[model samples]
Target: MPTTAFSAHYSRELDVEQLGWLLSGDRPGDDQATVADLSQWAGWIRTDIRCSSCGKTGAQVVRPSKARGSQAVLRQAHFRFVDHQGGDGHHPFCEFYGNDTGEARQTDSLLNFGSEKSAETRAVRLLVCKGIETGLFNQATIRAMRQWFFDMKSESRFKVRATPEALAWARSLQRHPSYRRWTFHPAQAEMPAFDWQAAAKFQFTEENLALVELAKTVVHQDAEWKRAGLMAAKHFGQEVFNTAALQPYYEDTLTLCAFVAKNSGISFGKTSPDYYRFQGAPIPLLALCALMLFTSEWEMNTAIAKFARLLASAEPSDLSLGNMIGLNPFHDYAAWRLVILAAEVAERSLKGFDYQAQLTAIESDLRRQHAIWKSAG
Candidate 1:
């Protein structure tokens, strides 16, 4: 039987082994690892995720027409992935759905430290994978489920036959040595690129999955943690615009930031000053990783001010340095705001610092900036 799949527009059909390579091939020998049981994995992924391609069903599928709002978090990516196929005049081919990945949530402090649209930044792949039951969904379904990824913002420019473009995009990410060597090429060399559209995939743990659920349940789920994440994204969108576009690094960082803050409770202990210094020395999501300390307004201002100097003086390629010039308005503004805030907070110290005042100033400024941006239109 052809199976009761949700949707398809394949120029061709893929067999089980081919599909296995498609599923785990991104990880060098991972494809070989799955060759024997890939169908089982694919099935699990497919049947478990929300089947958004055809109907309003599965893990997180909602009608395209019914879907609204901008996928603001995903900086350089396309919109078609999250909102249905035709949400913003895009086609409806990939019909994947996502949910929460349940991970841990925060560390407390010495009667000190501190801390809201707590929205769920959708990472459909992780969502579906986390939601999948170990024994229920099948491998075929998993492969089919991933079809939803095609709908996501393509990694590079769009063309009807995107295989080459996608491969090029993957190769261009050569700066990220981790994925370049191990995670991206296997699928293409072995399974064939674009056998399915060059769909970009994302995943998360079950704990993260639950946190997302919590965010949706109440606007006040994890106040300080969520705020920290927003600050980090804003930091990326605004000042650290390394390239003309604040594309590549924002989404993942946001997820990671939010994940770390909320989960630090059981996962790691309270973040200390040492942690901040350790991060200051590197870039890549430094702002987000720093999310642990901004419990109060004062820490935020000091952090931002310190960051500005880092931007002004540090070697630009320092991962954090590159982020200073990335792209994305939200990211830029926050980063800039922090620089300013950090400076102002430092001024409050007997040494020229006031912890309490720092937090207050930041909140006030965040509100003002947010309003300005909203009205700039």
Candidate 2:
């Protein structure tokens, strides 16, 4: 089952955590709620929520509440699909299919970072180069790539030595003549030693700290907005931040921002210099390489689609070059900045690689996968 559901009322997807916040009577702009308001919103969700992917109704929003037992226990809110007469199920090719089935898993030993000649590796390298050149690379894309890698690792049929092999293979890719230009350069500033395992750790501590610092500067003008900012930071700290897993917290973060805006009447339109300062922080080369090597066309396309929606919904002023370079109020500003930095590094490193052949190979593979899925369906 998916952790997120599409809300027809809002015309956007929301995770169960966000729904839980709403159930507590927290509206998009206000934290305060009355019993009547809570009941009303809960009814709204029951009517409007549906499958994010297939748009199928019969999706239910489960709120966090105490269990009816001698020792009462609290449960976390989540989304689930329910069956009833004539109700539609998920689409045949939806990613949710086979997710919880007891199907045989692929063996890790059988899953290798194939040689340079392999189509998957070439496709990944080419896509990264193209993304940087086209100015489309961002945090969501990076997250998608990482998610693909972790999905593979998690689906291994048998336990195998993965980390050591993955690290060595990634290092070899980084050292290749075509990739070396981007991974290492004499004129570039000193970088941390290449460590795939270490780089995989999502160190949001610095970003969260920077966000809190930004919030502090705004306290003089809007105390409620400041509170919302701090609350968002705290929420980030409380949630598990893993580069390798699906990012449900991103929705949670956005929901918190929406709450502050709707409840407190604070406009996040004006650009803040402090937000821009933190955007300039450096992302590691090895991490970028890891992202490129594991990313699939499907994952990249999904990420790009979501990013496109964010851009389409943003205000014209929010799309200014300076605002785009740093954080803006449109989406997850901190995450967006990270993507920008990553793209810069990627573009500089992939300056001279030939991309045409890789593109051809990728398109061919995509067509083949689509055909197979179609036949299966």
C-alpha TM-scores of all predictions: 0.17, 0.25
Itemize residue pairs with steric clashes in candidate 2: 28-258, 28-259, 29-259, 29-262, 29-263, 30-263, 106-157, 182-349
| Worst 10-residue lDDT window, candidate 2 | 319-328
Q: What is the C-alpha lDDT of each candidate?
A: 0.26, 0.33
Instruction: Report how far off residue 210 is in candidate 1 (Å).
Output: 44
True-structure lDDT of candidate 2: 0.33
Deviating ranges (above 4 Å) for candidate 2: 20-43, 65-75, 86-89, 97-377
Candidate 1: stretches off by over 4 Å:
1-55, 58-91, 95-157, 160-377
| Leading candidate by lDDT | 2
What lDDT score goes with residue 194 in model 1? 35
Task: Put down candidate 1 lDDT per residue, 1-377, tens digits, no spaces.
Answer: 01112223322122222233345654333112122344345334344322222333222211111123843221111111223342322123221121111111111110010110011111112122222222122334434323422322323221122122222222222111222122223234244333211112111112122322322221111332333344344333232212212222333334444444453332223443234222211121333233212212225444344333332442222110001101011222222222333222223223222223433454454445545665664
Per-residue lDDT value at 205 in model 2? 19
Model 2: how far residue 252 lies from native, Å:
26
